[model samples]
Target chain A: MDSIIEVSGITKVYQKRKTKEKIQAVDNISFQVKRGEIIGLLGPNGAGKTTTIKMICGLLKPDSGQILINGVDNEKHRLRALTHISAVLEGSRNLYWRLTVRENLEYFAGNRGVSRKNVASRVEDLLQKFRLKDKETELVNRLSRGMQQKLAIAVAMLADTEVILLDEPTLGLDIETGYEVREILKAIAKEENRTVIISSHDMDVIQDICERTIIINQGKVVTDDRIEDLLKLFEVRSYTITLGEHLNEKQEHLIKERFLDYQYESNRIQPKLSVELLKTEDIYQLFDILKLNETPVEAIDREIIQFEQVFMKIVKGETTNGVDQVKSQSV
Target chain B: MEWIKSNLNLFKANFRKETIELRRYLPNTIAMLLTVYIIFMAMFAGIHSVGAPGTVDATIQNTIVNYIFWYLTITIVNGQGYEILTEATRGTFEQLGMSPSGIWRILSARLLAQGILTAAMMIVLLYLSMLTTGQSLNVDFVTIIPIFLLTCISMFGLSFIIAGLTVIVKQIQAFLQIFQFVLAALTFVSLSRAPFLVFFPITKGVDMIRAVMVEGLTLNELGFSNFLVLTTNALVYFIIGLATYLYCERYAMKKGLLAHY
Candidate 1:
């Protein structure tokens, strides 16, 4: 796919007003967004997501690096480069609170160089698409958070720009509204074939909507890969085995050495061993431990690991390979 | 032609938005009118009680022009500054930056719309102040137009400087207040008595405006030399103000202050 947005070695540093200490907000980060790709920009709080977004949107100048939008350098030709992109920033910052929904749309459309005659029809179309037709006359402040977010996105879409940048699109929204927004974004990305770069704390948003994700930590990209590959790589399957009798000391020691997170329950009526295996083949090692005590395996059940857990594990610096030493010791 | 059309459309759109906001916030407009009225009434009462009814009318007219001059200066300075401050606070600065219109076009459109509104409001208040004082001052807008345009150009320059400063300096209100007082003193200074003060922004232009209103000096009657001096003040300050504003904008963007309130 042709790249619509190319961000190369972009860095930004901010100075604390009082202490005069320089803080690197974005440290030599680089990524290319292909056309029509919905890529999730994931990070923890204060992880330079907003700073990166601002640089790409031309709101802030990068300390060093180049950002090209549709082959135009944003820093050199801001107005020309920015014409190809539209951003829906976090919160109500992008919206005019005092203006009605329809007014805001028309105003931004005009501001974005949309023709005078087409603004009305374009706003009408977005109003219907975002389900904001009923509240078109309502003031932006009067709309709920979810509706405001929808309107913000709708306003960005009004420009009909090729690339849309959204910072925390589903932040502070209810589950149902969040779900609705996710579906709306998915439909837009697929049907419109518009490139989208979304920064969100919600893992579900990344897992469900984005095909690929760039995870940042401490102002740096820690992992940039496909969501499916990440899930498969960090697939930690947990299994519980019911034993006829309690395990001896050697077996207990062996179980502790093999698994990173597991529970050995001996006092209950059914002695069960819950083991988290990083690799599927580790189940053989687990059965070996249980067989040492001649304990019969009555039943076994596996626990499902979710994308949220995978995200947590990755962010906490516990990559799937981090436990290979335990696996080596068992051998 | 296409570029000009797009910029004009942006200007018209911004004007419409400002008008809608003015209509929606009726109390703010009313309060602004009352504030001007009260200030004008105090000036009228002070001069009337001095027992100079003959000079009272002329004095009131002169004061009205001066008041309008001061109002335009302060409004342009603070209004443009606050527009940026408010956008930053509301987080719309990024959105504005992302638009194809650019900051220069956006600010120009907004400031032009605001200047027209302020000029209209000043005219209405001038009439109301005259009626309330039971005195009529010969006011000629045709004569005022040339002087008004020159003065407003200089004032717009000052406004650009203030807007730029507001971007770099987070707490600029205190500085703006102090600068307002300095501007008042310079603008009210007698150019004939202390001729050197005419170089300051809006100083000579306000004096010329007073001459047009109180003395009924036509643009031709004001003489080319005096007109030239006012023109120089307007052009020089305008260029200086624009340069300062552009410099401040570059620094602010480098420091990432555009996103900060």
Candidate 2:
């Protein structure tokens, strides 16, 4: 697939007002969104997701490096390149609060120089698609937050841009509304043949809607891969072992020595062990420790690590050894 | 042609929004009209009580003109730019920035809406003054119309400057308050009968308009020298305003300050 949006080596630095210290908001990040792909940009708070999104949509000029949209340099011909992109930054902040939903849609369409005849049809289509027809005449400020958010995305869609950038689309939303927004985004990505770059902290939204994710931490990209691959990679090494009896002091020390990280709960008679293996043979090492004590294993199940936990581990820098392990396994 | 098309659409959309918003503040508009009427009535009554001096009519007319100018300036500076600055603070500037239209078009549409609303208010005040005072009509239409248009453009230019400053400066509400005081002082000092003040641009515009409206000076009578100075002042102020706005735009882009409120 052709790359619809290519961000290369972008860096954004912000100067503190009082002390004048330079803060790196986005540091040397590069990523690509293929045509018709829904890519999630996931990170903790203050992770430069917003800065990267702003740079791509031409809201902020990066300190260095280039962004190309549809093979056109975004900085050189910003207007032309922006013609292929639309953004819903911070959700309802992009909307005209005083204007009605339909009016806002019409206004943005008219600004894009769409014909009057086509504007009505386009606005109607968006209203229907976003399920906002009942609130078409209501002022944006009067609508519920979820309705306002839906209208915002619908307005971006009205521009018919090839790429849509959504910054925290489901932030601060109720669970039901968040799920509704995720479903709407999923539908847009699947049915519209449009490329989407979503910056969000909602792990479920990313896992369900996005095929690939670019995870950032402290202004740098830690991992960028397909969602399936990340899940599978983290899953294989994770296991939860249920023991038949508590381990002795020596056995506990040995288990702790064998595993890179483990959690121990002493209250339970049958101790449970959650372990992440670095090597395939490490499982035998765990078994050997249990065998020495004649410990009965009630059950040992391979744990499926959720994307949220993987995200936490990646941000905490546990993935460096994991990457090394993967390299050795491939060799 | 494309610029015109885009600007016209922006103007229409923005004007609609402004109209809707202003509708909610109808009480303020009503109060303003009443105040204009009462102030003109009081001025007319005072002039009548002063035995209808030869300069009384001119003085009253000048006062009314000053009032209208300051009223419009305060509204534009305080109300219109306040809305724009609030939007900027809320990150709505990014929405406007991402649109196909240029910043100049957005600014122009806003100014156009302000101009129309100001003109409407001025006309209503003029009619109310005429009805109450029955002031003699001596204004030269040819010169007065052009002068009025220039004054409107000059005020619009100032409004743009204020909007641009609001983008760069953090505390715009305080700045706007200071601007209101400065504008009041400028209007008062320039329109007053002070010989040394004639060199100021505000004084020049006011004196020229007063001469045409009160003294019944025709274009030929005013001479090319007077027209040259008035137009030059208006043009220079307009150029300075545009230059300031361009500088602000570059600064905003460089500093990422466009959405900084």
Candidate 3:
């Protein structure tokens, strides 16, 4: 697929007002979001995710690098580039609190130079689709936070731009509302061939909706690949071993010493040792420890990993030394 | 035609927004209108109670014109700054910044809408003050509108300056409060008192309107030279204000201050 958004070597630095100390928010970050692709941008707090998103939205200028939206250079022609993009930047705050749901939608469309009459039907569709038709006449301030968020997304959707950037879309939503919002985003991506870039802390949302995930940590891209690929790579390294006999204290200590991330569950009906081995050959060392105890191995199975664990490892910079390095060696 | 239609759409959207807000904040709008009216009446009473009967009517007429222009200048000019501050606090400034119609155009449409409404309010105040002082000043919008519109251009220009500054500083309340007096000085001081004041923003337009309203001058009677100065002042101030605003906006974005709140 052709790329719709190209960000090349972007960096943002900020100076503390009082201390005058410079902080690097985004350091030489580069990525391409292909058309119709849902890419998740993940990072911990103060990791420059918002800064990078704002720069991509043309709301902030990077110290270096260029952003092209649909081949239009954002910095050189920010407004024109804006024509191809919209964002749900601040969630509920992206809307006019005093305006009704419908008014907010119409007003935003009008700002894009689309006449009110022209967008009336699309507004109705969004209202119905977002489950906000009943609240169309209600003031945004009076509505629930979830409804306000849905309205904010609806307003961005009303722009009908090629790319939609959502920063923490489900940040403060309740469980049901978050699920509803997730469903809405999924529906939008499935129906429209629009490129969606979502920055979220919800790993489930990322795993469920995004084909690719870009994990950023300390103003750098730690990992950029498909979610499934990362899962598969991590899964292959994790093993759950069932033993026919319980291990002695020495064997348990040695096993723990060998695999620092090992889990021993002798309290269960069956004795088991679960561990993730960075090197697949490390399993031989694990079996050697079992041999010393003369413990028979009942069954061995690969442990399935969760996206949240993958996100944690990637953000902690452990993936580079562990799974990512292993993948490079395999390649 | 495409340009016209696109711009008209922007204008209509913004105009409708302002109208809806006015309706929503009806009590606030009415209170502000009443405050201005009461203040004008108090000034009229002060002139009435004081001596100097010979020039009382003349001063009253001048005050009416000056107050109208001052009201228009302050509300529309300072309004831009207040609007930005509110938008920033509300977290909607970035959305407005992303508008393809351009933030400048949206603000221009907003100010124009406010100016029209203020003009309507000014007429009521003009007639009300005339009734209070029993000094029947001319109510000729035919002559006053051209002058009012020209003066509004300069006011809008100053508004742009404030809007730009607000984007950067984000706390322009103190500056805007001080600017109220600056605007007052510009609107109240006549060019005859200081001929150089003719070049100042809003001053020339206010003086010309006062001439037409108090001195019974018609559009043709005001002469083309008069228009040349007014139009030149409007355009010059407008260009300078817009340029300053655009520069500040780019600086704000570069510094990542677009939506700090």
Point to the candidate with the largest TM-score: 3
> After best superposition, candidate 1 residue B188: deviation in angstroms?
3.0
What order do you get sorting by DockQ, best first?
A: 3, 1, 2
Local distance difference test scores for all models = 0.82, 0.77, 0.88
Interface RMSD of each: 1.3, 2.0, 0.8
Chain A alone, TM-score per model: 0.91, 0.91, 0.89
The candidate 2 chain B region of ten consecutive residues with least summed lDDT is B192-201
Candidate 3 residues lying further than 4 Å off, grouped into runs, are A242-244, A248-271, A278-302, A320-331
Off by over 4 Å in 1: A249-263, A276-279, A288-294, A322-331, B51-54, B134-138
Which candidate tops lDDT? 3
| DockQ of the two-chain complex in candidate 3 | 0.83
List TM-scores for all candidates, in order: 0.92, 0.88, 0.95
lDDT of 2 by residue, B136-215 (tens): 64656678778777766666567667767876774678778777877776565654457665444355666677677667
Off by over 4 Å in 2: A113-117, A245-271, A279-295, A320-322, A325-331, B39-52, B77-80, B138-143, B185-206, B219-228
The TM-score measured for candidate 2 stands at: 0.88
lDDT of 1: 0.82
Predicted candidate 1 versus true structure: per-residue lDDT over A132-164, tens digit per residue: 999989999999999999999998888899999
Task: Give the Å error, residue B193, model 2.
Answer: 5.9
Give one digit per residue, the lDDT tens place, for model 2 in A1-331.
8898888889988998899999998999988888988889988899999888878888788889999999999887877888999999968888888788887887777666554566778788888989999999898889989988999899899999999999899988899998899899999988998999898988998998898888888898888888888777776576788888888899899978878777766578777888778776788998899899898999888866789987887777665335653211100
